[model samples]
Structures are given as structure tokens and as C-alpha cells.
Target: MNSSPPLSNLLRLAAAMIIITLSVYWMIFLRGLLVPILISVLLSILVSPITIQLEEKGLSKIASIILTIVLFLGLIAGIIYFATMQISDMLDVWPDLKRKGTLWFTQLQNWAYRLFGLRPQSQITKLQEMSMAFLSGGGSAALLKTTSTLADVILIPLYMFFMLYYRSFFCEFVYKVMAKSEKQRVNTVLFRICDVVHNYLSGLFIVMVIVGSLNTISLLILDINYAVFFGFFAALLLLIPYIGVLIGSLLPILMAFITKDSPMYGVGVAGAFLFIQFLEGNFITPYIVGSKISINPLVAIIGLLLGGVIWGIAGMMLSLPMIAILKVVFDHSESLKPFGYLIGEPVREESRRVVEEHTAENPELITDEVADSVKEAI
Candidate 1:
């Protein structure tokens, strides 16, 4: 009888795992259509506060949606234009860059030979050949890829606008779908999710600006070319977790080594980025983004890697927010509350604050004895 129960439980667990795996695979397969919609949903959440503020200040729902989207698109357009200019400037010096790049490649080969007793030329040549084949050998494949990208660009904004416009209807639908007894708890979750997203985005912007400015100042002190662009570029790459900063720092260091008269400037670039990243990882992000999401670095990196495995780059981009949303959901459900607590930062005062807020919001949620018990526990 004991063996029978254990076997049954194992089978059930295996089935659940299979189902979850298949569901994720299906989502990835449907990403062509789903990614844009998902991106729009996230963008809508980020801009919801602005939409609400505009509505409060006398704009109609449609008008507010249009304005918010326009502003959002304008920012994107600005970035595109800036990047285009930078690319044009780069192309103007491509011949010089190509020569310098060849020199750097030779140095890299020598360094590899000295360090690993391996020739990098064959590997580099193979990579170059593969890249050329992928880019140039594709006729219909290239055309289809371009068409899909254009479609996504158009559809994402349209979806974002519609999502923003239908925000109220969506909320109503959510409320309607749940039981009356669960409505308060659902609303609480909704409010908390919004707060988390809004604060996370706001804090992200501030951190980016702060980091970018610091990078610019440091690069300026080192007399690096296009310091502003490189600074902001490094800051922007921070949107990707784990390996992003290193990749961002590599480009500027390479540029500094190739373009500057002294190789020491490259060292300075590396040092600057390392210090900035250390400050950001240790202090800026912890205090700002962590304050909103309350997710630790270890959990975030694991979630990011898992999401990337499931959904590729889109999965990685969505992972942190998705985890935060899951945490909110888990915390509210009695059965899942332990998982929620496991994901959250280890801070007892935060729980006490949450309890105090819960009591304030729903005063009759607990009896006097229960409240006293909570106080004592806190």
C-alpha cells in the first residue's frame, strides 16, 4: 500500500512536469505572434500610470492612450535616430577601423597562442565563414526575416495602444472571472503588481541615468571618443542581466585600445566599467529595483536563465517582471505562500510592514488576538 501511494505520487509529478514543459514549448513555438502581444502588455503596465494621470487631467481614454503611445514611440524614434547617426559615423571610418581591427586580431591570436598553445585563426575564419553564409546565402529566408521584423514593429505599437485603451475592460474581465469572495484579494494583488511594475520602471530609469552620467564623466576624464554614446550604451545593456555589463564594457575597451594613442586608456575603460558595475550591482540596483521587486540576485539570475531557456531573448526580458508577478500571486495564495516567501528577500520587517498595510487596508481581516500574535511574531 505504501509503495502504491508513492508510485502514484511519482506518476502524478511526472505528468505535471511533462504538461508544464509542453506548455512552455508551445508558447515558444507561438512566439512570433505572442511576443509582440506580451511586449505590449508589459509596455502598457509601464505606461499605465501616465495613462491614468492624463485621464485625470481631462483627457479621454482614447486621447490619453494615443498621447502615451506617441510619447513612447517618440522616445524609441529618438534612440533609433541616435543609433543611426552613430552607425553612419562608424561607417565613415570603416577602412581605418578595418585596419586597426586586423592589428587587434593578430594581437589576440598571439595572446591565445601564448596562453593556450592553440591557433585562433582557424576558429576565427570558421566563424567568419559561418556568419557570411547565414547573412548572404539567405534569399527568401532573409526576406521573410525582414518582413517579420517589420510586422512586429508595426504590431507591437498597435497592440500596446489597444491594450492601454482596453485596460479598464481587462480589469473588469478579471474581476468578473473571479468569485466575489476573492475579489478583494484579487484587487490587492492587482494593486501590488501595478505598484511593483511602476516603481521598478521608474527606479530603472533613474539608475540608467545615474549610471550613464557616471560613465560619461569617467570616460570624459579618460578622453574617450563618443563618450556619451558609449556611456549610455553600457547603461542600456544593463537591461540584460548577468553578462550584459561585460559585453558593453568590452566594446569601449576595444575602441579605447584601437583608437587611443596609449593602451593604458583601455585599462582605464575596463577599470571604469568594473567600478561602475560594482556600484550598480551592489548598491544602485539593490536599493532601487530590489525595493520594488524584493528579488535577490541569485533568484533573479536563475529565473532569467530559465526564462531564456524557455523563451529565448523575449523570455529573458520578461523573466524578472514575470517572477515578481508570480511572487505576488504566490504570496496571496495560502497554499503557495511558502514559495513566495522563499523567493522574497530575507527581511522580517518587510513582512511586518505588509501585515500593517494589510490591516490598514482590510481592518477586519484578523481578530484582536490574531493581531496581537502577529505583533509578537514581528
Candidate 2:
């Protein structure tokens, strides 16, 4: 009793698929130039207020850009210096740590061997071999192999400087390209993009600073060695989302266990990081970086997977912001509204409808169909 999908519908679907594939291909291909530019644009947006302030105070555009870049580099250099100093101090005690680790690992291995009577080492060996193969390959070669994109991320500053310096020209060009009637829409889109990007990046950094300070103070109270190192590193890892949660918690817990005699210290370290993450996720993020990036989990996960395919880990890191940017673009454009809806988090009626339809049949079987229908409904 069902009719076949319309020929027009089929053609449109085919066309959309082709466009998406080609777009991804181009992204992967041109990533060398695009990646740096993208990073620079994000940086410029984050710091534009400062640049504008400087310009207002009588600094030339070039001078303002130079000063901003200099300040940025100085901040980076200071962090690198402190991190290196902490690492050196840690390395000074690495021998003792190594002994502790080796002894524990061997005991675990022996117990596992006796209990399981299976060769886990072969699998572990395979993993080691793969890791070594990846490491032994040069960084650039590895980058090219994995991402098919540029190896060097070092040029991001250069791109950022030029972008910031020429930002006005670019803005003018954008205005010139559009009809006067569309100017308001264009400006609205631009403002939304800038606000999302700036708020997202700036708020993320602020969260890192707050979380890192809280962690360091907690570790210091517990008298953990390398407290600053572990705390800051763990805090920074929150940038990676779910994977960040596991690794961030593990790093400090492992250090506490090794360096302190009490098992409670390990528990304390784990609890602190977990508690901080919970607070950040539930409380802090909402205030600072909330609805600006209200992407649904489904959309975000898909972006991460596709990003991994096209650009590997770097792509994964950038995926959320990119999706957020895309959502803004989609919202403003009439033709692309469906796409905006598709990629965005199901906020109201959308999520409710998906749930209702999903439960009517085998909920599990109908999930993807519900999602597709929702997208079509958009």
C-alpha cells in the first residue's frame, strides 16, 4: 500500500549525498591551509574585543595585532616554561616511580597469568608494536598518513595574525558580496557565529583555569608530589569531552597511589577530579558555555566520528565548534534549515516526538527511523 519515494525526492537525496561527500573530500584535501585559517579565525574572535579596545585607544591595526600576538605568545611561553620546570622535577624522581610501576606491573602480570592461564602478553605485544610503529614514523609522515592534512600546526599564529590584521577587510568584503537587502541577515549570522565561537573558546579556557586551580589546591592539601603538574594536565584534558574524563581522573589517581603511602590519597585524587567534572558539567558549563553549544549528543558523536575519519584526532577536537558554526549558518539560511535542525540538539518538540514514536514499536528497532523522520520533519 506504500508508494515508492518520489523521483524528485530521490534526486534531491542523491544530490545532497554527493555534495556532502565532495565537501568532506575538499576539507581533507585543503586542510593544510584551512586548518590554520580556521584556528586563526577562532583566535581572532576570542581576542577581538582586546584588539578593538586597543584600536579605540589609538593603536594602529597592525600594532594592535602585533601586541595581541605578542601577549598571546608570552602567555603560551610562560605556561610552557612552568610545565617544563614541573616535568624536570618529576623526571628527577622518575627512577623511583619506574621501580614502583615495574614491580606492580610484574605482580599483576604474574597473577593474571596464573588465574587466566591465557597469553595476554601476545595481545599486549601487538599493541606495543603498533604504538612503536606509529611513534617511529616521523610526526609529519604520521600526520600525513592519518589526516592527509598538513603536518605542521605551528603556523597557526601566523595565520591568526594576518587574519586579525585583515579582519576588517574581510568583513567589508563579506558585506560587499551580499545584496543590501540581505545585509541584516548576514550581519545577524556573523554576530551569532562570533559570539558562539568567542564565548565557547573563552569560557572553556576560563573553566580550565578555575578547575585547574581547584585541583591544584586540593592536591596541595593532600601533599601530593607534582600536584600542579597533574592538576593542570588533568584540567586541560576536559577539553576532549568523554575520553578526557577517564584519562584525567586516571592520571592523578595513579600519581597519588604511587607517591603517597595511603590508598585514601588515591581515592581523594579520583574523587576530586570526578567531583570537579560533575560540577563543571552540571553547573559551571551551563552558566559559561551553555546554550551556545547546545548540540545534542547524537549530532556531536556523529561529528566526532566523521571528523576522525577526515582529520583524525585534531578533527575530533574541532568537530563540536565546527558543528556549532554550521548550526548558526543553517539557522539563518532558508534552504539549509533542515540541516540545522538535523545537526542540532533536540531541544523541545523534536526530542519528545522522537521518544513517542520510538516507543510505539520495538523502541530499539525504531530509533534510527525516528531520527530520520525528525530530520525530514524539519
lDDT of 1: 0.83
What digit string (tens of lDDT, one per residue) describes model 2 on residues 1-378?
Answer: 879998999999999899999998899998676766777788889888888899999999989988988898899889889999999998898999998777656665677778977466864796698888778875537555545343444577777788898887988888888766388888888898998899899988988888888889988998888888888888887667656666877877888777666679989888887888888888887777775676777888888888778876667778888899998898778888888877766664376456656666565666776665754343
Report the error of model 1 at residue 378, Å: 12
Candidate 2: residue 298 Cα off by (Å): 2.1
Give all candidates' CA lDDT scores: 0.83, 0.79
**Each candidate: RMSD to true structure?**
4.6, 8.6
Instruction: Identify the leading candidate in terms of lDDT.
Output: 1
| lDDT tens per residue, model 1, 141-182 | 767767877999999989988888888899888898876648
Please identify model 1 stretches exceeding 4 Å from their true place.
1-8, 111-146, 347-378
Score every model by TM-score. Answer: 0.85, 0.82
